[model samples]
Target: MRGIAAAGAYVPRFRLPAEELASAWGTSHASGIRRKAVPAVDEDALTMAVEAAERALSSDAVDRDELTLTAVATTTPPAEEGELLPRLVRALALPKSVETATVGGHTAAGAEALSRALDAEGPALVVVADCPEGDPAEGDHPLGAGAAAFVVDDDPSAPVTGTAWHTEETPGVRFRERGGEEVDSLGVTTYQRNAVREAVTDAVSSLPVDPADVDAAAVHQPDGRFPYRATADLPVSNEAVSAGTVVDRIGDAGAATVPLGLLAALDDADAALDGDAESDANAESDTDAESDADDAGDVENEPNGAGPSIAAFFGGGTAVAVAVEGGLAVEGIADLDGGATIDYVSYLRERGYVVDGEVAGGGAHVSLPNWRRSLDQRYRLVAGVCPECGSVSFPPEGACQSCRSRVEFTEFEAPRTGTVRALTVIGQGGAPPEFAELQQRDGAYAVAIVELDADAGRVRLPAQITDADPGDVAVGDEVRATVRRIYEQEGVPRYGVKFEPTA
Candidate 1:
């Protein structure tokens, strides 16, 4: 009965229109796609995973103390050689004793992570994140970025009814070299179509329920057109498949595609069931006795028809099928509407493909040991409260800033949502060498001293303002903190909290 107790997703606020991409390369837009989600310059697979994981955990379906394992799947990790699970674990504030695992190098890794979580001994969190890159000139412009997370446990409300998997050697469909950044394809349309069809058919056929009876189907989509063509022969209807399709707006999110699509289907099913329940309640409350009797009889005869059942299909070189019986929609799923659109050159700059000249040896550098010691303050916004004066000091300075108290200060976690107390705009060429690249990618940004209300007192901390223009931000604006890449030092991406205007 292990199933998804809760689920969450993250789609970046920045989008690149397909027409803009086509204009840059002077080609037709990728077939059946309007726009693709693009991660901000400070975002990557790890950061996006953190965003999704936090949303999933906020549901409180699985308590943090009860979580025993954390598994992450991603094709585009921040670094190939380092351990990413620790960072995720720290960001989520999970127990230090929790087990961790990283899965990647293939697009099917997301399904593998979910399977492991279902089979594990205790409750586990499965996170899938990817920022896929493809050369536009090579006809691979649909690759995009996104993340999704699920909490798996023995929850019967959303039971996992059946599961199956299929794998085969299908080379040259899509792959990357050992040290390559871009995913390469051989344009083997016939070969790719055959592989997707065979894998999906075999996997779906193994499910316990009849395929035609499935209320919804979520299939891996490398593009908008593939899912429909692959599921054409299946017993499921086109409307059922279309309920889970998301690539038309978000593009190909690699490991995150199927999971994101499944979430969408589950949300739709939950909404429908809720609407039906409300209607039934209203009919019973009305003055009509015959309608009540009819509804009662229908419920008695259809005891098994509580909620929509969903079929999920994952495919890369490997394919997995999972049947889900019921669902409870997770809150805070990223809204895909109204993202800021950027032109092609700005997109290139954000992706690091086109950088203005590099400046060497400028910004302040912190040693690994120092950075490690301050993770709690940076990631969780932990502050220190003065025992005598009750003043809060951010970064937990040993002494009280108000009364100069020598006594040990109490630790406190500052609120993430706050008000801007002061602000300044840093124009181009005025940034330190460390921020030179960021300044180049995003011209003229704002810095704000935000005041966060803590239990003991107010704490003011200086941080860079993101997702807003320098000219637009003001002293009274409301903002929220989110983890993002600050800069890279010694081959590592440093992460810190940045403030964005509250939606």
Candidate 2:
């Protein structure tokens, strides 16, 4: 009876076109992809997961304390040593007692995380994200960056019936050399394609319902064509499986692919239900009008429920098939439009491959005690509210600034959407060493002072601008807060919220 209560996805705002890659490398074939989403210089797998989790939590309105477990699955983890899930937990403001785990090094880890969430005793959160490394010459197997998250509970809107899985200890199929950035792609396509197809076939045969009766279907997409190719021999048709097919556009998101495809399938199901409801409403309205006029009309209301949806998630050596019923409504998670395109040089710089093969100055070296002490203020942006004057200070200082009240201050809620009040352009020679790569890749970025009017009082914050042209941003522009990578110090990636102009 466990299923998805809510779902959400995150796609980066920058895209790299295949045509541009071809021009840069002088090779026409760039994985036959049109374009792929590119994370900003300040974006990564963890931040994208945070974005997706925020959307999922917003749609469900579940109390943070009620979530008993949090799972994050990613092949490209933020750091090699430190725990990743705790950072996500702190950022989302979940209860410290919530159990956390991280699954990695395989594309199928996402399915594993979701399966665990489904088996939990209470509400659980599963997040999948990846930023794979590709060959510089080949453009990283045409990699794209993104994340997806889902909330799972017994009384879920989309209930999962069961899962059928197949796995083996297949080694050397896909791997990376030690201390290498590029993944070796030797003989990977043939082995992976056949292995996935065989495993998926076996999985489908175990389902109770006939494959032909499935309302919608999705498969793990390594390339744009892999899904269609793998599912061709199955009983389902291409149209029925359209929701899970996204590799042609967004490229391969590694562990994030299956969950994103699941979101798409859920969205398709939601749209169909909406259409049916709207049609039924119209029919009833017409019937009412006819009854009022003493004429004749007939109207029928259909029962509300979700049909069966089949999904297959592939890891390097494993695959899982899931059948879900009573699917939930999807927020706008699949919209991949409106992104800025940069050239190959800019892409290289953005990915931190420029500047003598190192990111500038390695940024700030934040100590452990300082980092742990400011978790609430740094991650969740929690402020301190003075009980006497009700004024909020972002750092949650010891004493209230407004009334100098010596009493314990109330913790203010996180910042909401705000507008740019004052701004300045940081051109070349102005960016800090930590952001010099950003300046080199994207010229003349804006640093703004943003203002928000809350119930307590007016709040002002200084932040950097992303996903916009410096010339286009103005004082009155409205913006939303998003988690982004600040910098890496001592091999640790620091993340914080930055404001982006809302489109």
Candidate 3:
């Protein structure tokens, strides 16, 4: 049973409800159309891919060097060709000879990239990304941008038992004009559901295990309806669907949604294990709590054979379904699961995050006491009206470029809420030696600007999004800001801003 070894997920912070677009454009799509990821000016598909891949490697049990191949699946790129992999590989410090495969031309190329990984002569990193150009007048103007990645390993948590492909270069769900034009949507609803149902239904039915016995399912994160539509056509129930539905909340992330959704599910399962371990111990006299998770390492070598069977599915519209049975040998994967259990107290000590006060209950997201953590909504945001124009900036910068005048800015807590005004999928290039000099771990990260709701069109700058799928994001959806590390621009550890859904 070549089952799952580990999984990771990611999502952009900003969201704009499709309804908002519908209201603005006075069209049906504006009401509930698809959304895309919103990358900050500093980000690209390469950065977003790196972010997703890092999470996959970090949260899953895996190794860095074990990734011998990198298959980058994207629809857009700064350059059509030219060692793009090197830019990312250099950042993550991956192997020098790692084989690189770039698959573009279509959004569904994500699944194609995964297929490449499976066929790889060796272990590989599979990255899928999408960040359509943001065109205001176009219907897809609010395309959400995002990416998801996975380090291939025959691990137990996220095993890849057997993979099959069903592809057609024929006419797809939507097409565009000659060049740089808005997409032409035809039977959009019918197309989405039909494609998803055909692929998933065929794959599941042909597999050995029955749908009733499958504990979980991770399909494309295009919409909340995808799960219901795909599953209702099969034997699975509503409960069987996982909560990767960040689209309404965050706007659709182009490439990272499916992988992000899978990672989210894996995180959920790991958290559950932690809770059960704690609850069981608390009820007893003392937690015996092993006091040290490392101590049980040698013990874990012996098979417990007592966990549920999990399924993960990713790729563009109507991608193939994958099923991994229990029991498989994946080496690099176990290391990632080790990360999910890291104690907040220990993590802080290791990273040396700012200690403002007593951090007892909350994890790193919390502040010591009155002060905030390195990454927090309050710290990442501050309201300051332009000295010259009187226009406000959510993050409150020193100089007001608007009026070019320094006003006696009164301090006001910035609103954490916002929507995705625009986004793009891009790559990181030309970095100073400090950030660029170091061995790069991953290539991409998801970044976005959140349009503050209270401030009308004001933005919170950039923020890292979590627990979301790029496809699940939509324009006009409600969102809130959070402080997080987008990635290290240089060894200096660049502080960043990101958004997530209010719900």
Candidate 4:
């Protein structure tokens, strides 16, 4: 009965149109791909993973306290040897005793992580995030960024019935050397096509269910064309494969491609079932009154009749196929909305390929020890409440701000939704050295002092505003806290809460 209880996905809010890239390099647009999702200056695999995982956990399909394991899969981790799992655990507020593992080194790692989660004895959270980059002039494929997460447990929703794996050494199709920033490909069309067909056919052939019986299929999508091309000789129909094709919109998201496609297919299957039930109800209403009870019962049972779905993931000389049946789709699992389109110059500047000059220096530097100590306050909005005076203090100075009491204070988590109390716009040269890069990439930005309600008292926090223009934000606006990159210092990203307009 173990399967995906809930699923979630994240696509960055900035999109670089295919024409933008084409115009930048004086080349024609890649066929079928319109645009690609681009991460903001502050966004990377870790932040995007946290965003997706939070949405999945919030679906209420699995209890947070019952989660015993968390596995993250990513080909582009923020730091090579850094402690990524720890940061994820802290951000999610998971128990310190929870077992954590990181999986990577190939694009198919997401499917591998999902397989392990379904096999685990207890509930597990699996997250796959990647921001694949390559020399735009070298390959026809457009590299993009995205993330997907799933909660796997014995809840019986979207039950995974069968799994298979196939692997061989097909060198040079796509690879990234150690300490390299871009992915390289051999551009061998015949070799790549043959490898995909052989691996996918072999894995699907080993499954217990007939390939023709699969209602939907999500295949590895390095590009919009490859996925459809790979399924030409398979038993599955083109319609079934098209149900999960997403690369045409968001481009190739590396480890996240297959998982995101699966989420989309699950949503489509659930929607189709809903439509069928509606049709049955409408037909039943036209029947005689005597058959109403029987017709209603049949309609209630219709959602459970959905057939099995297949998802095949292939990359780095490996392919995995999984069969899933009968599940409730989490709402809005594949919606990628509220995005802003940017031109080529902005895209290059944000990607750090068009640095105008040396990075401005002289911003005050905070020690790593101090930053570590404030993680709870910075990431989770944790405040301290004075037991004696009913006053809340941010960053918990160990002394009550109102009563001046020197006793220990109880920790409290502040509400994420708040109202802006004050605001300021930092335009161009007004930005500090730490924020100079951000200001340069993104035009003028706003900083706000937000007021949050606590158990005993209100807490006010000063934070940078995002996802909206500075001129558009004003005092008294409703806002919500979101984790984003604050700045980079000492070759490490500093993550903290940023306010964004709720509307």
Top model by TM-score, which number?
A: 1
Q: Residue 363 lDDT in model 2?
A: 46
Residue-level lDDT tens digits of model 1 in 1-503: 79888788888878889999778778744676688888888999988998888888877576877888899999999997796898888877899998888999888888889888988877899999999887867445787788999899886457788888888878887788889888877788888988888888888888887877665577878888887877776887665566567777787888887787777666533334444543542342231342234335431112112234454545457888888876666554544444789888888888887787866774688998999899997889988877788777776776778887776778877888899999999998888888888888878889999988566687889999998878889999999988888888887888888999985
Q: Report the candidate with higher lDDT, 3 versus 4.
A: 4
- What are the per-residue Cα lDDT tens digits for candidate 3 across 1-503? 33335443444433344444555567633322344334543355665665566556664366767777888887665345554566556545477788888886655666677767766654678777656553454545335556667666553445665554454333445554555534344546776667667766776666666666554455554554565676666776444454323343334454445544444333333334454443442333221232134125432122212222333343434456665443323222232222112222322222222233332222223223423232233333556676567777554555664665656665455655677765542234422232221112222333456677664335456544443444455666567654333433212233334566655
lDDT tens digits by residue: candidate 4, 1-503: 89888877888888888888777777734566778888877788998898888878887667877888899999999888897899898888888888887999889999878877877889999999998877756453477788898999886668888899999888997899999878887878898888888898888888888877665688988887787777777888665676567777777889998888777666533435455543443442332332233335532111222356788999889989998876565544544433689887877776666666778677889888999999999888998888888788887877788888896878888988899999999998898899988888877899999998555688999999987889999999999887888888998888888988987
lDDT of 1: 0.77
Worst 10 residues of 3 by lDDT: 299-308
The candidate that achieves the highest lDDT relative to the unseen native structure:
4
Task: List runs of model 2 lying over 4 Å from the truth.
Answer: 28-32, 268-307, 356-368, 405-407
Candidate 4: 10-residue stretch with minimal lDDT:
297-306
Whose lDDT is higher: candidate 2's or candidate 4's? 4
How would you encode candidate 2's per-residue C-alpha lDDT over 1-503 as one tens digit per residue?
78888887888877888887788788733454577777877888888989888888887446668999999999888776676888899889898899887998788888899988988989899999887878777637467877888898877878888898888656665666766655555556777677778877777667765777665576877676777767767887565466456555666788887677777666533335455543532353242332223212311111222346778887776878888875565554644443678787878877766644335574456786887787776667677787788788766767777777775668876665789999999998787777776677666789998875556666677888887888899999998887777666666777777788986
Displacement of residue 1 (Cα, Å) in model 4 is 1.8
Predictions in order: lDDT: 0.77, 0.73, 0.49, 0.79
Q: Evaluate model 3: give its TM-score.
A: 0.54
**TM per prediction:** 0.92, 0.89, 0.54, 0.91
